[model samples]
Target chain A: MSDASELPVGIADVEAAAVRIRDQAVRTPLLGSAALDARAGGRVLLKAETLQRTGSFKFRGAYNLISALDPAERDRGVVAFSSGNHAQGVAHAASLLGWASTVVMPADAPPLKIERTRAFGATVVTYDRATESREEIAAALAARTGAVTVPPYDHSMIMAGQGTVGLELAAQAAERELVPDQVLVPCGGGGLTAGIATALADRLPRAVVRPVEPAGYDDTTRSLAAGERVANAAGASSICDALLAPTPGELTFAVNAALAGPGLVVDDDQVRAAVRWAFEELKLAVEPGGAVALAAVLAGVADTADRVSVVVLSGGNTDARWLT
Target chain B: MSDASELPVGIADVEAAAVRIRDQAVRTPLLGSAALDARAGGRVLLKAETLQRTGSFKFRGAYNLISALDPAERDRGVVAFSSGNHAQGVAHAASLLGWASTVVMPADAPPLKIERTRAFGATVVTYDRATESREEIAAALAARTGAVTVPPYDHSMIMAGQGTVGLELAAQAAERELVPDQVLVPCGGGGLTAGIATALADRLPRAVVRPVEPAGYDDTTRSLAAGERVANAAGASSICDALLAPTPGELTFAVNAALAGPGLVVDDDQVRAAVRWAFEELKLAVEPGGAVALAAVLAGVADTADRVSVVVLSGGNTDARWLT
Candidate 1:
């Protein structure tokens, strides 16, 4: 295991990011439902990042990274590649900070997300998920426009910013006199999971942090098991478009590999059930990708009996019609 | 206007209710969205009571009233009549407090609500909405079973309990250094409306508290304008089944008549649009009844330009199929 000193993101960095994003991002509530607690057979606290600015926790990282840019870099703008949530987050954060942004998104990403990203005043470029590489398109655009390429994850600033969620979760849980035994977080490139694991290492050291992924896209799970990053096989797909990252980020995996618990995976059916449960019980509009952690909990992938578990609903950017 | 001393429910009662239900009820968050603010042309703070226990604000009043009952009354249990939200609220509250509950509900109430009410361990008795009197059925059940009758609204304790929403809203807004210029609440029997008006009257005296209702079943709106209680037409109907109170409650209307601003009304289409907007933008699963206040705001029924308005999403108990 890597020592704390070697970690790319630390508690102090997350605290600093909290201070920077305090005025801009939403301190979304840590919600509890008796119904959910009963179903999980444990004390369940939900970190509702679905209510955060731009409908996801991605805004925290986007804002923190962009805001830290030097004047010369800030004036040139930012570029990013994402399925949807990260795109909307970068677009909205850039718009708020008066920086131009360009986002490369998969053409098959949810229509609502594409519309919202554009609505946030960012230039959107679409590519086929099957054949084209969004990273290359974003890189080409950033080179041409002289904009800084803001990767969706992997950066120290982005990981630190997402760590604020862990900071808030621990504090909110403390207010209710709770010490979480486990925390389930949705994972794409593992930035949020790694960041949360790092933060909880200081706040609640004994708490187990688990990265939850959609079944076919469980690259993070396989990578963690293999003790190195691994890519998903070609043509594997799931309804959770936002969590289709081929592999975990290098910087993120370095932290998660040391601190996070065994990764968990849930299938599309489980994800759909979790989304419906959020709508019916929590009254939160959670997307399929965001509901994977919840899907894990509901599917009994974790031993929650008599324990306090915190589940993060990471984003809510989807077409309502898809739910029906 | 009636003096504070003459009111049946006051800020003190609401404060006491807040303390009584503090541990049991979910203190839902005051959420805001930049997208929503841009659309309203003002700062729009959403009081998300849809996240409240039992998925509505009704649980607050139900719990407060049942908890305040004497030992003998508690032993005998309680009976209530509701379209849906109130039934589930009273049932869950009673179940939590160890009191047996019997709820008389409209037969046409949403199937999900009926199922949830029963799931909460309440004895459910159905009455035809157009042909039978639920009040008489509940009164008779209470008389025969020696159970206390917990009216949906009319009682002072119930009003004060619902008023906790307003108390929390004002305090949350204050935390953000904002003083709401107006507050919009969905009105069924005026219990929640009067409760909030009373709370804000003390906390934010200058703020206008308006009750929003669906157009066809707008008894509260008509009653507020007519200077006397008025009932909707016998055949009047709307998709918002939870908000079809025939007329305002006696005690609730008395408080609302003195403290509330002009009532506002929105059509079913507007309410549907508001629900869709809430799902897409606010990431909240707001039911049609819960969306009326939002509908009024989105439809420009009130002047929101350059103002800070608080809109209460009162409940989220509806069939997902209806949303489609």
Candidate 2:
């Protein structure tokens, strides 16, 4: 295990990133999860990034990345590749920052999110997921226009941006004298987890940070075990579509590998149950992807050890059709 | 119409109430209504009381009521009658204040709410709505034991408690340097509408306050027109079952008569659409009764009037089974 001092995400980076994106984003609330805590055998504090603009935490990293651009690079515009939340974040951030944007999304992306991205005055480039990847299309666009590519994760700016969540969590908790013993964070490309781990490693050096992944796609665990990035095998299954990344990011994996414990996988049933739990108990209509950590805790994936825990409800943008 | 100086609720009361309840209840977010604002030709802010503790603003009043009790009355415990949110509120408030509570609820109350009430350590006294009125049972219980009865509405203490929500709105808006031109409040027994009106009547004296009711049970509107208390025809007719009260409270009606305009009613379809709109657009799972004001806006029950408006989303305890 790497020493806490060596971690790339530090308190200073989180504070600086917070300053950079302070006026550009909303400071979402960190609320108490009494019902979940009762069920999960420890206190649970939820970082409600779902209430963030564009209904996701992607705004943090997106705005963080875009805000760091030089005057020249910002004028050149920015491009991002995402099928959902990140696309909206890039579009919204670019629009607010007065920079033009292009979002490359899959043809199968939800129409509502697509509509929102377009409404934010970003050009929407669609690709057939069966043939071309969104990254490929975004790269091509970036090269053609010299627009900075603001990736969802795997970049210093994005990691630092994501770190602000931890920064906010630290500040909010300090106000109430709450220092959680464990924090279960949902992992996709590991930007959120990496950023959080880096930011909190010092203040909460002993607080265990667990990365939670969907059962069928436990690449973070596998990668962490092997000390490198790992890709999922062919034909995995999951109901958490937002967490369906095929592999872990190289930069993010290294950071998480240094600080994070072994990742845990929660099944579709638990994800569905957590989705319903969030609706009933938390009164939040979070998507399956956002409920994975809460699902893991409720499903008894975490060793409570009679300690208080915090779970980050990363986003809440689920399609209405999914509920139907 | 009553002059601003004569209103019971004032800027000072709201500030004091906010300080009193700051730690006890959630400071539910003020959600911006972009679409609703566009349609209303003005800005709309939603005071999310639906996100309040116990899933309703009732908790605010209940908390204040319990706290206001003399030590002697508090030691004797408390009793309340309700089939819904008030039961939970009384139960939760009693628990918070370290007082014993007995709640008399209609036998037909939703099973989940009943279970939640029971889980909160409040004694449950189930009554047959077909054979016995809950009020009679609660009054008997209070008489038999000398336990104080906290009426859901129509009481000065409860009204002051509910007024705290309006107090919060004024404080939050002032922090942002914005004041609403109009406020739309959901009406059942009229406690919430009257309380909010009382809270804001002084500072924003010219701000129009409109009370919204379910279509088939528009007692507040009728009572206002008749200049007397008006009762609804027996039985529930709208999906907003929580708002299907037989009559408006005498206390609330008197307050609303002075501060509010002619009332508006929304149909069942509008309630469901507002519920759907809340779920889809706002990412909040507000109950049907809680969505009534937004329902009015969506159904165009009120004239736009080109004034910035605020809607109270009063509660969020929807049946979990209903969402699926």
> What lDDT would each prediction earn against the true structure?
0.91, 0.81
Model 1's DockQ? Answer: 0.78
**RMSD per model, one decimal:** 1.4, 3.6
> Candidate 2 — which pairs collide?
B9-B198, B50-B315
Residues forming the 10-long window of minimal summed lDDT in candidate 2 chain B? B4-13
Give the lDDT of residue B243 in candidate 2.
81
User: Across residues B1-324, which tens digit of lDDT does each residue of candidate 1 receive?
Assistant: 878889899999999999999989888899888877888899999999999998999999999999898756567989999989999999999999889999999898898899999999899999997788888998899889999988899999999999999999999999899999999999999999999999999999999999999988888888889989999988887878878888888888889899996899998889988888888888889999999999988988878999999999999886565556
Tens digits of per-residue lDDT, candidate 2, B190-306, equal 888888888878657777778899888899989988888988887657777678788988778878888876888888888888887777667788888888898887777766657
Categorize the docking of model 2.
acceptable
- Chain A of model 1 scored by TM-score: 0.98
User: Which DockQ values do the candidates obtain, in the order shown?
Assistant: 0.78, 0.44
- Residue A246's C-alpha lDDT in candidate 2? 84
Best by lDDT: 1
